[model samples]
Target chain A: MKKLKLTVAFDDGDYVVYAKLHYDRAPNLIAAIEKVVPFSNPVRHARICESEWMLSTPYLGVEDENFSYPDPGDISLHRAGPHFCGWYERISPIGTTDIFASVASEDLEEYRKKMGRAWEHPGAKMTVDIVEVDA
Target chain B: MNPIAQELFETGDRYLMERPEDIAAMRSRMGTRGQNMTVQIYAFSALGSSVDAMYLLQEAVAKDDYDFDTVVKFAVDWLSTLAPPADGSQGAAIIGHRASVHYRLDQLADLTSRASAALKQATTRAEVREILQALEHYYNQVRTWIDLEFPWHELAVKYAELMGDPAPRPAP
Candidate 1:
């Protein structure tokens, strides 16, 4: 039961943004996401079953099923292509997603709007850090 | 308030009342016949080009800009588009909806790949953001195609078992 951080840095590493993970609620997705910690990925705005902002965590091993629609500020991991995703708005994912974290920004809405397409930028890369919060 | 949003709300309210089983599907696990509401929503999401309409509707809800009639109309436009599965057979829309969801998923993956490639050619935050926003606009196009079609899975994992497209070891 811990919160992980998804930190994104782009513009030649001049910019950085952090999203907090909510693993306590979703015990199913943590292991898959953790194995590829400190991995770099670009964000994609996915719109299949539902359109939402998603970060990629390719080549991870996980098989947790907690199918649910995530709201804004929720971070989720789906094994379908091993996607490490976050929600910036109301759109849902195509299938079941085990939500493991969230962007722990004070103004989540602002963070979402500012980082809208930063991940899609070729230079944009995110490093997810698995941190345990104080109990 | 968009007129469509209003229509969507009335339809959803009426549908929910008449078919409690659809509500049950959302609350608990059920078969395709029980998932009429879920399929409709899924199709609606596929029909939408982007999350912008939901975003706008959310904004309206938060700001009290949306009235009762305007609330649900934006997402349930699919209700109007679905016919009785052509030959009036069961699971017709369910199969169709599954296909719609898969197609949209494929389309999104392709768009992301293409956008990333374009970003490679154009560096800088502004250029990258521009490309992403363009993709967003495309995602937003789902709304106009209310006339267009759109799964199951809560029916996918069952199939994912055959496709081996999902994860092997999930969170414990």
Candidate 2:
């Protein structure tokens, strides 16, 4: 069977995280996410949520002019491996941050926890609000 | 042939005769000039992978009741981080010579937008085929760029070293 691919970019006023996903393995990954949260039409709402999520953690902060998205030429779908992959940059504060601690330890873990709770009941759709932040 | 070129040819010939999969594996292993080549290959590989992923999602959207927005976002989120390890000054030269990393990122964003649109409207098989074909073309272009930049011999030597063998051919 062929694989399914999707890409996402989050502009948090100061930074952008570009990501790609393989849908074949994670068919419900996105829907599962939507079930937990709703997308705010304006980008800033999500930004604030991401920021709030980061702020709650000691290791996370918004950086200046360090934001980045994926290189256009660098897109692809691997036959086997992680379902998704991509790069990110700090846009506002400008500096390198620890990936394991900032993303894996704090943000991703939090997301997983929240998602778990939202998914506790079958077919429960979580409402996510994305409010646009001023650039 | 240039010394580097000659070594690459010998290495490739030896690998073809004895270790074919090793040749492919060499492309993935990092370090030295081979790592540089691998980065270039990876840049292209990213494109091919993106296309493959996009095609898959398009197919799913067509036949299944999937959340299109969520799926697109999921794909984009992953695509944004597809980078080779930030080592190798040699590879940096190649990547910079082509364009700064930011340029590549912009291109990816544009492609993602296109893919998102295609997915949103993907109701027929032909449209999906077209999107996949476009991705295949993008992949081919990346391969061509790699070929032009590294040629076969330098790539072979790099591959040989990456495979943990001493430079496959003796110095001229």
Winning model by DockQ: 1
Chain B TM (all candidates): 0.30, 0.41
DockQ metric for all predictions = 0.03, 0.01
lDDT of 2 at B145: 32
| iRMSD for each candidate structure, in the order shown | 17.8, 24.8
**TM-score leader:** 1
Model 1 chain A: which ten-residue window has the lowest total lDDT?
A117-126
TM-score for each prediction? 0.38, 0.29
lDDT of 2 by residue, B44-159 (tens): 55654654664465455455476655654454343334422122212223223221242243333334344434433455544543443343333333332332334544545787
Give lDDT: candidate 1, residue B6. Answer: 30
Candidate 2: what lDDT? 0.32
Candidate 1: true interface contacts recovered:
0.00
Candidate 2, DockQ to 2 decimals?
0.01
- CAPRI-style class, candidate 1: incorrect
